[model samples]
Target: MTADPRRSRSARHAQPSAQRAAPAPRKEPITVGRIADAALEVVATEGYDALTIRRVAAVLGTGPSSLYAHIVNKDDIDDLLIGRLYAAIVLPEPDPAAWREQVTGVYTQIRDLYLEYPGVSRAALAMVPTNLETLRVGEGILAILLAGGVEPRTAGWARDALSLYVSAYALEQSLVRQRRRNQDQEWVLGDEELLDRFTALPAERFPQTRRHAAELISGTGHDRFAFALGLLLDNLRPASG
Candidate 1:
């Protein structure tokens, strides 16, 4: 044993090698899903207008060119963002008796989601509902309308109308919130202040506006949303046979 100095030295080196920990696993490669997640994070933190392909890529620690391999362009990212948000909605089975309630619930879900990521609804305005998830929502609403005996054409048109209303409502709310955040914007006033301003207009020429100032600022916290939704849904009568 004493004569084998080279073998002893090799054994000491091998012992440290065997005891050393293995290298850490590599980070997961970027995918479409990961890209979508990063985009949402950007929108959530910085608002939707701040979301760009380059920003998303920076969030994912990659270059914009790499994202192009997974997504087409900024419009493509908008589609993905809206599609991902729509995917979270839980569609209900059509019930003729409860169609109105079900439709209201779905629209409420969409409104809440849009509010969660301010300005995200702007992406929905120009979208054509081509994404599978977006189409799924449209299909769900159509089923409910048809179940309630609405004519096919009416149901289709009503779906579009309701979608437009929700998107516009969300976008308006987002814009108001943004304005409120900037205190320097005089137009961003409380309902009472707005009513006062309306009432302060010249009397003779602005009689109607002054008289109806309270009514003009009447609704609060989606009361207008509910009223408009009811107006749209309540008028949908089944065609006479």
Candidate 2:
């Protein structure tokens, strides 16, 4: 009679069956990911300014001492969250056929990502994207510039210029959105109120800005954004060799 392999295999595995079923002890019960997740929860509900180590610990059912075992400080948590978030972003491959479109598309994706995460947008200000995905974005942009015959230095600076533009614009929008939200309950001030305050200034004192009021605030906020993006893209065209 042929022996059943299943029975033989079962007998061999039976010796350490208890141990096999035993739950593995977690290496360092708390982890950086856990701390980051806790922090994200706090930010999602409470906003950026309200995100604190103490609050995160409370969510994790741990004390500050335990959290310290994982993260160094509140700033460390913020940095980790930003880097982790950056790593998850998916940027398109460099396309010489559509380099300008690729660059603008990346910026648009990043803007949408920051706004979706709300509180994290403020923390991202002036911070370099040292994470892999972000660095990849820079690398992809450089590759496209190289394909278009841009100098290495110009390509590098273009990366910085684009990142700065996107980050600064996002931060400003976040601030404006927050300000409006905070005032949502009260009687919202109208654009006329803002213009009235501006025009009330002595004519000679603020003539330039006040004189071009229509020009200054002519379009929807995004209208100016598209214009700024186009202006920057126009500067990237390589001069004839």
Candidate 3:
């Protein structure tokens, strides 16, 4: 299928050295937006650590010097990737009856967007939201929270709470998936192999843990996230008279 003319995914993932060859020759100059978009694509495919000035230029059909004329380095691409991430979120028009639904919808969209560009989630780890687009999102989110009856001071905290919630969780998921992928490939542990360690533990020393081991290991992450959200929303409830 042809790449979307409007939004490009190539930036989300850099071409793997094995899969990559020379980028197709472009007749003219490429804009910063185009470079940023491509960087997002490279991150999505190759991951954050894999992102580099060389790789981004490789995707753009240019060299490092050409890319540097636009982006100073890989960190610049990371900053740009976060900007693209901010673009994906859809904020609600703060309304009373619709506040809950609106906030819920916005959160769900954000969670799903992080899932799309897994690597971009790391950009939130130590990154600041200095970009204008990112600031606009914060403004919109704060408006939604304040309209939902949260106090102005409380609503301020909610902005950080919700934003961090999604990014932190997404980053954890990326780490978990990467770990599991490596484990599956290197040792190829069988189901029984993982179970054997637990089974071998001293029953007398850790009876309670053994009893609930299956529950602890097999519970879904989605259920945990929903539970956390449920608790947050409950805490954010307006005080009673």
Candidate 4:
């Protein structure tokens, strides 16, 4: 009995083509979480200026297109960076009796988170909340204000004001650290020396500056932050009867 050759040929051809076997896509198996972490690393090591899709992709051993599969763009990455930092902030429950302290505590935690990641704060300047974590932080803040008897408009404004103040403060702190890190190792001046120079300025013309030099440069970052925060909190008054 003869086997049918055409049937055998058709069966062979019908089998899936190995030649057409597309090489499994070179996906780097990255997750949104991993990409977000890599973004933070880039900000921490190189500052926010170096945080780009290309840079993050390189850090992740993948291409920018692969990152797009998980993140949308630079703005999206900014949101993630801010979100990552905010995720560490544990906002306190609103206490009407202690709302001022609670609000301060919440922002203090936020500032610390920013400092932890260094340049991540730079990405937060003027950035609207787009991620869940960031929004959660905002909600916590607003709740504190509302509990404090702040009107809706006042609560909203206070929320924005606090966020701006904290982010701006963090951004300035990061920039100073970055500058110091970039300065010449041999030519560095201590903070006291820097203040002394200010005081040493021509006393004839810069009298106030010379007299108040110590006061002007007084306090650590935390001290100045607490002072400024106090000013804001102490002045927030509810509507008078």
- 110-161: candidate 1 lDDT, tens digit per residue: 9999999999998888676667888888899999999999999999999999
Give a tens-digit lDDT track for model 3, residues 1-241. 8889545667556566677577887666877887887787788788877778888888888788887777766666777777777787777789976666676677677777777766567776567666677777778877877777888777787767877887888778777677778855655444566566566689999887677666655646777766666667667865344
* Candidate-wise lDDT, in order: 0.90, 0.73, 0.73, 0.84
**Number of residue pairs clashing in candidate 3, backbone atoms closer than 3 angstroms, sequence gap of 3 or more or interchain:** 13
Where does the lowest 10-residue lDDT sum fall in candidate 2?
Answer: 183-192
Model 4 residue pairs with clashes? none
Task: lDDT winner between 1 and 2, please give it.
Answer: 1
- Which digits, one per residue and each the tens of the lDDT, describe model 2 over residues 141-205? 77777776666787788877877777777777777777778856454445677667666767888
lDDT of 3: 0.73
**What clash count goes with each model?**
0, 0, 13, 0
Superposition error at 14 for model 1 (Å): 16
- Stretches > 4 Å off in candidate 2: 1-28, 128-130, 184-189, 192-211, 237-241
- Which rank order by lDDT, best down to worst? 1, 4, 3, 2
User: Which residue runs does candidate 3 get wrong by more than 4 Å?
Assistant: 1-26, 183-204, 237-241
Judging by lDDT, tell me the better candidate of 1 and 3.
1
Native RMSD of candidate 3 (Å): 14.4
Tell me the TM-score of model 3: 0.73
**Candidate 4 residue-wise lDDT, 1-241, digit = tens:** 8989998899887957655766787755798889889999998788788888999999998789888887767888898888887888898888889999999899889888888877677677777778899899889988888888888888898788877898889888977776778756544566688788888999899999888888887789999999989988888876554
**Number of the predicted model whose TM-score against the real structure is largest:** 1
In candidate 4, how many Å is residue 209 off?
1.5
